[model samples]
Target: MTSLTLAGIRKRFGKVDVIRGVDLRVADGEFVVFVGPSGCGKSTLLRMIAGLEDISEGELRIGDRIVNEVQPAKRGVAMVFQSYALYPHLTVRDNMGFGLKVRGVPPHERRQRVEAAAATLKLDALLQRFPRELSGGQRQRVAIGRAIVGEPDVFLFDEPLSNLDAELRVHMRSEIASLHKRLGNTMIYVTHDQIEAMTLADKIVVLRDGQVEQVGTPRQLYERPGNLFVAQFIGSPKMNILPIEAVAGKLPGQPKTASLVGVRPEDLELTEPGSGFVDARILISEYTGASSLLHVQLPSGQVFLVAHDGEAPPADTSVGLAVEPGRLHFFADSGRRAD
Candidate 1:
């Protein structure tokens, strides 16, 4: 296992600055995830660590060695891509062993290692099946098995389940989480899916544009985001953003401007029209399998979502939304978090 450190890492393409001075330290055997919207440079930063992309500035160290100039193959990192990247004609056994074969390992040793990885990934029964013959989850398992066979210091996954169907993606996510537990190796995953990030990561780095917005554990990022971007980005149904003037009380810090309040859907409690923080008209109610989501419009014409029970609030129902102060997030006009 290895720890990864990236300091002031920056990358650009001609006029477009992709990654802007990202500083991060990933501990040994930690599962770190980089999560952000598309074009936020999460994947580019991962590529830089893999030696697939050059670091325009700053240093990248694997364990104690500075490896900014190391070749991709020599970096002791294996990346599993979203596309699976499996050979259509190769059986699962051959695909898993191909890397070992190319590295000039003996056939018997290669077979042993391949079988071991297959057993761990539960792909033993599908060893002779071609990629075309396997399900999406099975194919992804094959891809992971290929990476596991390399016994690399770090495993990099770039949205490996994005191509799979919804159910398969969920199954594959558990498979990956379990695989990490069994291997206990350092891993870095990149995805725009916040659910995956929240579920898989021991630590999460939230990026916006090209900068690091916040880095913390799943609970920290969820419970206490550092800025407006992070508060809004990390949650599933997205946090409710209310205008500063809508709420009456002043926050702890006296600031240059009034603060906008953010509350997660789960933090909101619907109450009688006059009992809660603000009165809003419920515009729409959507019932998801687990819970209901209410889209409400405040008196100031600002709209935000709130989590509700599957019971609809009645069409055009007016309700008061109350939130616990401990669950509240305050952001200044500049979009930075306010204490």
Candidate 2:
């Protein structure tokens, strides 16, 4: 295993700069993920690390060696792409051994390595199957196995589970998490899916337009987001934001005139008709399997969401809502959290 570091990494195409001055340190054997919207320069950063794209300006180090100009193969990094990239004509065994073969490893050693990886990935039963004969999940396992056989110091996954169905995606996610735990190699995953990042990453690096937005653990980002963008982006069903005047008179302690206040759906509770801050007319009630989401319209003509019990009040019913003081997040005029 090895640690990877990027200092002032930048990339540009003519006049448009895609990645601007990013500095990150990935500790040895840590599972880190990069997450952002499309065209946010995440893939570009990954490519730069893989040596597939040249660094416009910066330094990259792997295991104490400055590898800015080193070739991709000598960097001891293996990348698993979104498409699986398995050879159509090659069987699983052959595909796993292909890299070693090209590198001129002895035949007996290549066979041993492939067999070991196949056993680890549970692909031993499908060794003779070609790509066309395998399911999507199986094909992805093969791709991972190919990288495993290389015994790379760092493993890079570029949205490797994006091609699978929902059920298979969940299954592959568990498999990948297990693989990381078992191998304990340095892993860097890039994905736009927030759930994947939350579940897989020991640390998440959130990026936007080539800039680092925030870097934190899943709980930290979910509970104490630094800005409006991160607060809205990191949670499921999103946090409900309302103008400060809507609840300004209801909350305890002076709020120093914040521009906006964020309340998560789970943070608001449904109470008796005369109980708390405001009376809301239920605009809509959606019943998910485990919880019912209530869309409540406040007196100021603003709508907010609240999560209620699975068996919640009917639509158009009048309800009272109360929020815990500690649960409210305050943002200033600049959209950053007020310290």
For each candidate, the alpha-carbon lDDT, in order, equals: 0.90, 0.91
Best by TM-score: 2
Give the Cα RMSD of candidate 1: 1.8
- Backbone clash pairs in model 2 (N, Cα, C under 3 Å; residues 3+ apart or in different chains), count: 0
Stretches > 4 Å off in candidate 1: 250-258
Clashes of each: 0, 0
Q: Local error of candidate 1 at 214, Å?
A: 0.4
lDDT of 2 by residue, 1-339 (tens): 999999999999998899989999999999999998999999999999999999999899999999989999999999999998999999999999999999999999999999999998999999999999999999999999999999999999999999889999999999999999999999999999999999999999999999888999999999899999999889877898877777667765536957788889988998877687778989999989799988999989889889887688888899898888889888888989874
Off by over 4 Å in 2: none
Maximum-lDDT candidate: 2
What digit string (tens of lDDT, one per residue) describes model 1 on residues 1-339?
999999999998997889989999999999999999999999999999999999899999999999999999899999999888899989999999999999999999999999999999999899999999988888889999999999999999999999998898898899899999999999999999999999999999998898999999999998888888898888888888877666675333334464687889888889899788788899998889788889988888888788887686875999998877687787788888875
